[model samples]
Target: MRKFQNRSKLSQYLSEQRTKVSSIGFVPTMGALHIGHLSLVSKALSENDFVVVSVFVNPTQFDNKDDLVKYPRTLEKDIRLLKTLSENRIAVYAPTVEDIYENKVVSKSFSFNGLEHQMEGAFRDGHFDGVGTIVKRLFEIVKPDTAYFGEKDFQQLQIIKKLVELYHLPVKVIGCPIHRAEDGLALSSRNTRLTEAHREVAPFIYKTLNTAKVMFGTKSAQKVTAWVEKQFKKQPLLKVEYFIIADIETLKPVKRKSTKKSYRAFIAVYAGDIRLIDNIALN
Candidate 1:
């Protein structure tokens, strides 16, 4: 696997590669590698002639400076993990912040339309703007035929779909399934920060979502939401940030039960100091 820190060199090399290869698959991520990341890489390796995985910890995405500062940086370990996957050569673009955001440090306003008004977009102000900027930038640089993203960030996935549509980018945005631990906790880079006991309790987020899923079959949306909040409160260590039952297409909260439309349950929680989020289908 060849590693490139410079975006220019990587882009130039890929430009030449475009002539030789039929298609290129891209998996863009923040540095701390996990099973979830590898799953995306696995799909990319299977589908395309060449694959490029980027591990740049984007500062613009985080609203809080401390969160960005404290975010995991396991570059050597991340590379070691990625090496286990690709049988053929894979390009690992671990670019510096300057390489990605030379003049543009802050995100310019992006219209994800009203999709940006709720969920993680609502809670984390300018979060999706940072997401849009970085992703659009990477898409331009990599110039891949297809890009892979995990559905753990469901809202972000939807927004990127919008980003491609708005700009008329040729890249295909393939939403891969959210990978989970054997116990059902969604695999995350942030899982590294959890203390031993908290790690054990983390799967409760998924457990709660699954429970809500079954409850939604008989109960009203409001009732299921209240039940979710009450259930989380029972665990002293876990605190519910927001438990939303919404339409999958529009992402607007759906209060009434309807047979015609598909629904989903999304949750964000604070497990001690670390915040975790998970979602499940209500159908």
Candidate 2:
């Protein structure tokens, strides 16, 4: 696999590639690659002629500077893992911050249209704006026919889909399933920072969502949410950020209703200062 650090070279390469290829699939990520990322790359490979995976830990996405500093950067190991995948189908774009954005100039001011003021957005503060801007920039640079995103960050997937619709971008937003570890914990690079105890407790986040799902199966939405909140309260280690049963697409809170349609149970918890996110369907 050829690596290009220079923005001009990479842009020229993709432009030239655009002339030869009928379609391109892009997976933009903040590196420290994991099974979840590979899952995205794999999906891209299946659907498009060229699969491009970007591994730039976007500074704009991080609300706190320390979080960005603590974020993993296993480039060597990541490249090795990517190499094991179909080499001809994959390309790595690891550009510096300047390559993506001009010196001191950034894309910060974003209007999420009320979607940014709830759940992850409300808590993270400008998190979705950072996410939206960076994603828009990436879409502009790559200009792929399709882009892949994991549902682990469910809200992010929602926001990107909205961004595409609002802007009328000529790219398809494909939401891939959230990959999980053998023990049921959602595969996340942040999980690497967890201690054994934290990791053990991490799966409970998924378990709690499952619990909510089961309760939703029998009980009303109000009761299900109350029970889930109580469960999170019981687990002192798992500092629950926000747990809600909402419409999967609009993300608006759903009232107690009898329907076998799509509903989502989103969660955010702090496992010893390392915040982790996971969501499950409550159908």
Candidate 3:
């Protein structure tokens, strides 16, 4: 696989590829590559003639300075994993923070129709703005025909789709299904930070979401939310930050399920200092 750290060189390479290929796919990541990230890249390779996987850990997205400092960085190991996918078709752009932001590393303001003010937004202030900033910058840099994102970041995925619409960008943003472990915990880069005991109990997060999905059939959204909170309260190790069943589109917490609208259960749990988030669809 071709590797690039300089934005200019990567741009030149992509420009050349554009002439030879009909379509280009892009997958933006923060390094520390895992099977979940590879799943997105694998899908990108299947649909496009060429794929570009960026391995830059964006700084503006972190609301907490300590979290940013603690975030994993494994560029060497990440490239090795990507190599196993495809050598000729994949290009890894592992740029430095300076390469992405030039001088000032700051986030730009974006109106996601209040989508940003719920759930994660409620807790991590300006988190989505940073997400918007880095993603927008990368989109401008890569300029791919299509971009792939995992549904694991369901809210971010929606915001990115909105961003493309607001800017009238030609790129297609596709949200792939959430990749999970054998135990049902949604795969996340932060999973590596989980302590051995916490990791064993981590699967409970998904187990509760699955139970909430089944509960939706007979219970109100508010009741289900209460039940989820209660379930977490019983577990001392895992702290529930926020759990809500909201409309799949607006992301506003819903009181009851409707036949015309779809809903999803989103949860954020703290296993010690490591925070993990997961969501499940409820029909």
Best by lDDT: 3
State model 3's lDDT: 0.94
User: By summed lDDT, which 10 consecutive residues of candidate 1 come out lowest?
Assistant: 81-90
Cα lDDT tens digits for candidate 2, 21-59: 888999998889998999899889889998888889988
Q: Candidate 1, residues 31-150: lDDT per residue as tens digits?
A: 799989999998998999999999998888898788899899998888889889973557999999899889768887899778888899878989998999999999999998999999
lDDT against the true structure, per candidate, is 0.89, 0.85, 0.94
* lDDT of candidate model 2 versus the reference: 0.85
Better of 1 and 3 by TM-score: 3
lDDT of model 3 at position 278: 94
Report each candidate's C-alpha RMSD, comma-separated, in the order given.
1.1, 1.5, 0.7
- After superposition, the stretches of candidate 1 with alpha carbons farther than 4 Å from their true spots are none
Which one wins on TM-score? 3
Error of 3 at 45 (Å): 0.3
Count of residue pairs whose backbone atoms collide, per candidate: 0, 0, 0
Clashing residue pairs for model 3: none
